[model samples]
Target chain A: MPAIIELRDVTKTYKLGDETLNAVDGISLSIQTGDFVAITGASGSGKTTLANIIGGLDRPTGGSVMVDGNDLSKLRDRKLSDYRNQHIGFVFQSFNLQGTQTALENVTLPLVFARVKSKARKQRATECLQAVGLGDRLKHKPSQLSGGQRQRVAIARALAVKPNIIIADEPTGNLDSQHGDEIIKLLRDLNKQGITLIIITHDMNIARQAGRIVQVRDGKVRA
Target chain B: MRLVDYISLALRNITRRKLRSALTIFAIVIGATSVTIMLTIVFSAKGFINDQFEQNGTFQQVQVSPQTDINWGNGSGQNCNSSDCVKLTQALINKLAKLPHVIGIARQTQPYNFDGLFYGSKKLKLNQVVAYDANGIIDNHMLAGRDITQSDGNGVLTITSDYADGLGFKNNYQALIGKTVKLHTQGYYSGVGSDPVGRQQYMQTHCQNMGPGQNCELPSVQITGKVVGIADANGLTNSSGYTVRVPLSWARGMEENQDYGPARTSGDYCRNMPGPCMPPNVLTVTDELALNGYSSLIVKVDNATNAAAVAQNIRGTFKIGAADAETAIKQQLSVFNIVGIILGGLGGIALIVAAVGVINTMVMSILERTREIGVMRAVGARRSAISRLFTFEASLLGMAGGILGVLIGYGLTLIGNPILNHQLKGNNIGSSNILSLPIWLVITVIAGTTVIGMLAGLYPARKAAKLDPVEALHYE
Candidate 1:
């Protein structure tokens, strides 16, 4: 199988009061199509930064990143935003569902940016919510929903545009162990259906469940 | 993203903070309503004045005077000697009549012999007694009966409504028509309709008893005429409030200077006659109309557009003062234009302050929605989309305020017009609804406010668009 994403010596740096920190440094990685990969590290060990660069949310400061044969480092903001809309879905640890919007509306956000027809966007959003076992709570707002249900709504939003790759950064950080296990099972189910997945976390138990695991420490990959 | 989506989202955001949005819109309402009222008044006043002149056909007529300098509406020149003033004589009128573009002419004169007009027991002081050729060049707004015509001979005249009202016919001016009115002249008057034989007998009987150089005044003369029309007393078309209009033929007779004495041929006959023979009485009249000429001449051009050129031609050819209404109208309208600007500037100040309020509100809105903006960006909203959403919101505020203001202004006009109409009706003006809001003014005000709001939103929208997505996502 061909590699869907490739990175050769990618680096990202930040300056804090004249002190330079390498958030991501000298990383070369590849993920095949239809693969579930996990990246695990300690807090502030650059795992999330690596995931962000791969998802086209942030550009590498140096070197190159290629996703599906397009150079992510060379793309402008308009094209990068289009790439994210069409190809990548991000799930945050805090769920990041708009508190004021209904579950269906929250799930329809990405498809709206994709410029889908309103009727079709609504229909697809309902289907996405149902796939994450949230069909009954389509009209419920985030404040009305439990923690597990809120995370399910976020996952449903990530699946709205039928993205080819899903990047979840600490997706279960705020959930109990049982709810967290349920969310991991849902992600694995999506992965089993041929969507490439990348999970970023500090949990050894969640990392051990992926098909492949990469350990990150001090902006470097451990052997 | 689609434009509809941007609008929907913007509307939603505005509804999120209803109190703030309402306050911002209230500020804009003050500005828009003031602007609407000022513009409507200025433009409507200009339209009303222009309509009055247009109805009278004043724009198509040129006034010629003896003096070199003359303003419109003051047709006659001040008294000047023959060396310095060009008299509006018959020969000059004939020549001016033949000038190119000259369609018609009306010779105008004012006879000051009459002091009062009497109807029954009521006597009203006359402001002026005017006579002009009954041509179509000059028009009078008549409230009752008919204007003086070319066939109207002596004893036929028209009185303004004020004269009729003073004659106990206030609301019923038509009753004054066909009623004979007496024009009482000043003492020592010897104009038309005077009794020369009675004056001669009185002087012979009365003067013998008077001391040398003592004053011997003649009795006042009374001329009678049947009222032909009742003119509106609104001072329109250059007519005075208490004016009385008569035929030019009657005025010609009234303006004559009459002399009465013994005939020259009778002197030989009387000397050859026996004792106690009487000298024959004879009268000699001086034609004052020919000597002094008419007071002014009104020349009607072929078209209103040709009025100015014809006036220029008359001024150059005859060296007399000639003026068209266009020049005076422009000068008068420019005053209105300046007033409009000052009033509009005051309204503009209000709008500017409203724009500041819009800016402050938008900046605050962007701050409150920072996390939402970050989430939108992550969901693939372009930076341009965010900017457009806020701009749409601001312009919507302006549009709503402008619409509401115009509606309120329209309501005010509805309430104001009837009162104004009553006042005009009392003055005998025929037209009403002089206050109006033209379609262009309405469109201009709404579009202007919307553009102002869009400009005010630019800076804050840019600030929102330049927000860093990653940092904004974590913003509390």
Candidate 2:
């Protein structure tokens, strides 16, 4: 199948008062449709920055990022936001769920911004939560859930809009081996269902589970 | 996002910090209440002044005062055309009667003495002895009997209930109707007019060596008039609740006799004597021989708007000074309005402090929700959506305050009306409720408060919108 995400020499810079810092520099890569790709790197190797750029949460200072033939660099702020809502999903290490909200409410938040009608949004969010094995915990707030359950809720939230690309940054960083394995397994199952998956991580074992691994060092993809 | 979603989200956030929001809203309520109360006072005061002017005949009448040659407290100041004063003389009274728009031309009497009218042995000491043209004065205050009509002469008069009661007609106060009260225009002296000895003595005691301009007091002609009406109101002597109105013709004729009586200039008194000053020629006065002048002229016009034009015409043609009743009423009303504005301005300051509270709360809310805003933006909310959220929240706060304040204001009016009217009764002001808040006022206050809320939220909303979403996501 054709590549779903393509990066050509994408770069990201940071201003430090006077000196400039390149967070992600001269990076080029591509992933085919439905592929499970792991972006492997040590600390300061720019894997997180690359994940952010792909998620449309951060803009690269240079080069083009094309997802399904739509160049993200050419999109305006409004269109870029729509691109994130329609094409990409993000799961962070912290499992960014609103602590005051129910699991179902947390799942439906993305859809709320997507302006979906209430009845349809609730149905879609409930289905997503059930897919992540938390259907019965729909009314349970994040504080009432275990760490693994909370991570599942967050994963449910990411999948609510049914985007084509899922970007997970250190998805299992805070989990124990058993919980981490469950989350990775769930992600792989989702990838198997024909959704392209990209995981940013330092773990060799987690990277080995993906169909392809792109290793990074000093802000560039290793040859 | 749908408007409902925005509102729901705002509600959730506001409800989360319940105490803070309530306190902020309370500040707004206090501010709104003060403004509401003050404006209501202005509105009511304006109404009261207008009512007072209306009752005083300021709406349809213009007062024309002849420029007093001596000019002490006379109106028209430098604007008074002295030559125009001559045209307002009694001769023009009939001429002015012909002006098509001139509804009525009446002149008040040089006040009749309170002791002049006698009911048998008792002196009629009702309110002021008031007399004016047509039946206008007593027409407004008739309790019994009937007003003195144009055909009524010096032989007819109106008395107040207090005067009727004084004559021991308490059980049948209307009994005074058709009763004749002996009228004496001046003090009584034993045999002054008919006895030569008494006349000589009276002239020596009262008229000897009078000043250059001061005329000798005339021997008043006594003409008894029938009691025609009982006045319900006595504005002049409110303390005694007494008044007596007579026909304007009768009063003017009497005033003319008093002012230019005994038919004499100084030369006619001392120079043209036949023998020993001919015992002062006890001048035989005739109505045609008397000089006719008026203290002031009351001109009723077709309508209030025409009063100014009539006054202007009178001023342009005559030396008499004129005052536009409509203009005077409006001037008096404006004074109260300015006072009310000052009061409202003070209340506005309180509202401003309340607005500050709203601003503080909104800023704090924006700070607390930085991360939530980031999440919304990430999920596809436009920057404008985030700003709109805070503005809507602030406006909600203002709306709550405004509604509560207006309710409180209305409650105060309900409670204050009787108390204020009671206080005003002692001062003789009309007992109308003095706190009117019309629909426009209510709408203005609500819209004003909401606009204030929007303004207070503006800075914080802008700050929230301008926040870097990526950085905001990492905020704790």
Ten contiguous residues minimizing lDDT sum, candidate 1 chain A: A54-63
lDDT of 2 at B173: 55
Residue B4 CA error for candidate 2 (Å)? Answer: 1.6
Clashes of each: 0, 8
TM-score of each: 0.76, 0.73
| lDDT for each residue of candidate 1 in B1-476, tens digit (9 for 90 to 100) | 88888788878878888999999888888888889988998989888877666757889999888876787766654323377778888988999999989989999888776889988888877667888998877888889999999999899999988788789998998888899999999766676788777887888888769988899887889999999899887645755566899999998888886767777677687777888877878897777877788878889998999999999988998888898888767877888888889878988998999999999999999998898888888878778887888899888888877887788878888988998888866554645798899999899889988888888889889888888777777788
What's the C-alpha lDDT at position B282 in model 2? 52
Model 1 interface CAPRI class: medium
Which prediction has the highest lDDT against the true structure? 1
Clashing pairs in 2: B81-B319, B83-B319, B84-B318, B84-B319, B84-B320, B85-B319, B85-B320, B127-B242
Could you give candidate 2's per-residue lDDT for residues B232-272 as a string of tens digits? Answer: 54332111245566776666554432221233555667676
Which consecutive 10 residues in model 2 chain B have the weakest lDDT in total? Answer: B71-80
TM-score of chain B of each: 0.71, 0.63
Which residue runs does candidate 2 get wrong by more than 4 Å? Answer: B47-58, B64-103, B108-131, B135-148, B151-297, B302-306, B309-322, B347-356, B429-431
User: Judged by lDDT against the true structure, how good is candidate 2?
Assistant: 0.75
Q: Could you give candidate 2's per-residue lDDT for residues A81-156 as a string of tens digits? A: 8888887788878887787899999889889878999999999999999999998999999999988898999889
